[model samples]
Target: MPLVETAFQVVDAFTDKAFAGNPAAVMILEKFPADDILFKISREFNLSETAFIVPKYEGSTHEFHLRWFTPTAEVPLCGHATLASSHVLFTQMTEKQRQSGPLRFHTLSGELSVEFKTAAPEKLSTRNEMSLPELVMTPDLSIDRNVLCDAFGITENQILFVGSCHWGVLVEIDASTTPLHAIKPNFKAIASVNASAILLATQCGTDLHGEYDFISRMFAPNLGVNEDPVCGSAHSVLAHYYANKLKKSEFKAFQASARGGEIHVVYDAVAGRVRIAGDAVTVSKGVIYM
Candidate 1:
């Protein structure tokens, strides 16, 4: 049988112009496609991430089942893609489905909700609230400090260890000392040290003319991304780290990657959840008749 596909260009939680936000190619499938096919599509698109949607537990109140994949492998949770997928469903999907208000997705991370709203210029925006599970910081340091130093051409002393979660390394550096475009991680070497992924961030400390408190960049070569424009899961860990340090509950964060993006984060200490909220814009909409 012929394969069916649809694609949408979704701007991640970014408030600036086009191409500034993380662009994810979202595909809605009538049925689940083969793993090889999905990986092939991801490689062909060559974006930071791609999302595939399939129905789950027919008529169970939940709208669809979602999965996210990078160029090389699948990840547990992706905040930007989740927001993008919801935007695609709201603007491009049929009106009958669009009126559903909020869509529920069953993902590897957990159940997530995406709400839709109509904005100016006849454009639509979707607000995706990711359910960031509680983060458990680990003390084991298995990474080769030499590999990280060699990649960015920086000394090991500059890197400050924040903590580790299910992902991998979480390090912080001075915002002024490093430039976003200057990052060049040795994928092979970094992969050799860590298995899951690595997140590198810097403290903006109220420098940027925005509500965010800091700026960040995420690298997951092991997951087939040289650097992610904006990472939702990383922010979950970041929210915890910053909340503990700043003693604040809510703050703004910016991912200073080439495709820059912003996120409004709320840390619920009582609930043990970090809510990362952002608006997703639909740049293009079309169907793939396969």
Candidate 2:
């Protein structure tokens, strides 16, 4: 086969600054590529997730087809990558091609929408707001507590709540400071769990000094991403968990990874959705050869 060249860009999601958030590769294709091709490309990029965007003729004028792939497998939903895709459409797409209304993306998860809050001229990034389905979590009684405790390097008592969402397992810890930083997950132990990702969070008090409502970390060793710098999808579950716990619908969160990033979430229990808003910065633009 002849070399097929395609354009791809890297965007740091959930943060306005470059190299500080979870970086995702965005590829705009005229038509859907083969499944194997997407898998290979995602593996080559080696990011936690890569978003593929293609124009959709059906439905609304703003409709587009979107899919997300990790290095290992295709995921059902990815928030940061969806934000990155909208960032490309708002900042990179031609004015004539850009939609005046909200963007409707048809993905495996469902019809998702992204609304641009602010615009910059030919800039590195844009602020886009997206609402994802609220994941209802249930007590994670299936997994062995000993295995989870070993994976997280924490005692069973430190775990306040253990729950499971569609995306992964969520563990709420009691300590907000040193224990959060001291987490050194054993990847092997985590893989023994039932989920693909492990989201660990704690309510922020004096540690964040009211800047953020909570702090979190995401580990997806089974998905080939040991530690996601910033995870938007994970926050969808976190938002619901904290909103009820804190008795508030709006919240600010900080992902305490090495390359930290911020997220704002609003949960609407009646609507069964949560809006996740963040800023993204474009790092590089280039072509991929396959």
Candidate 3:
């Protein structure tokens, strides 16, 4: 008998332009497939991450279960993939599904909601409200200065340790100090100290464009991605930090990866949720023959 195959719609999340956002493979299956199969398909697709969908409570409520894999290992939660998966389901999957209202999804991170809106031609807009677990911020940044310098090929003075949230480390650099292309991080060295993830950011002072408040880059060596095009989880911490720093609840953030992206974030301090809004554009739709 021939091997069974599956098809998926690949979407670039957090970007309105092709090749500018994070690419994720969204597989809409009638029922939940085996874990091995999902892992294999994610490996085959070889994108930063892939999402698997199935009917959860009822036909109306979809369970968007996501498993993020790098070329090496799986991660707990991924923001861009989640956004892309929701976009595929709401915009492209089935006509019977309503496209005007908020869609709910259950994932490892817990119950999440995505609100869809119409943008310009060929562009779909979504605001993903992620229920981030309670964040723990501490002044105790035990990261070795030498390790950070070795990894990014920058001096200790070049790196500014912002704070620690959960298992991730936050750092800030001057926007005009150095360009992203000029600095290269030593993943191995950084990974030795902390294997979770690293966030590097720069202040987009009011002197620059007023559209955005800051620009940033995220690196997760343990998860297999050197740099993520756009990161929503990282923004959760950023939202709190910037909101306190700039004394604003709403701001725009630009991720300056090779595939650049922009995100509008709102900090709900009382609710402990961060709203990340952006545009997603579908680049291709196809099947995988296994």
Which structure among the candidates has the greatest lDDT?
A: 2
Clashing pairs in 1: 212-252
| Candidate-wise lDDT, in order | 0.72, 0.86, 0.71
Instruction: Kindly list the per-residue Cα lDDT of model 3 for residues 216-242, writing each as its tens digit.
Output: 878887776777778877887788878
lDDT for predicted candidate 3 compared with the true structure: 0.71
Top-TM-score structure, candidate number: 2
Candidate 1 local lDDT, 1-290, one digit each (tens) = 97655654545545434556787888877677788988887887788888998877654434788898888898888888887777666655565665666778888877777655543334445555555665656644676677778766668777766467776667776545555446666767666755577777766652342356877778787787877878887888788877887799888888877777778888888888888777777666666554
Give one clash count per candidate, in the order shown: 1, 0, 1
Each prediction's TM-score versus the true structure: 0.85, 0.93, 0.87
Which clashing pairs does model 2 show? none
Local error of candidate 2 at residue 141 (angstroms): 2.0
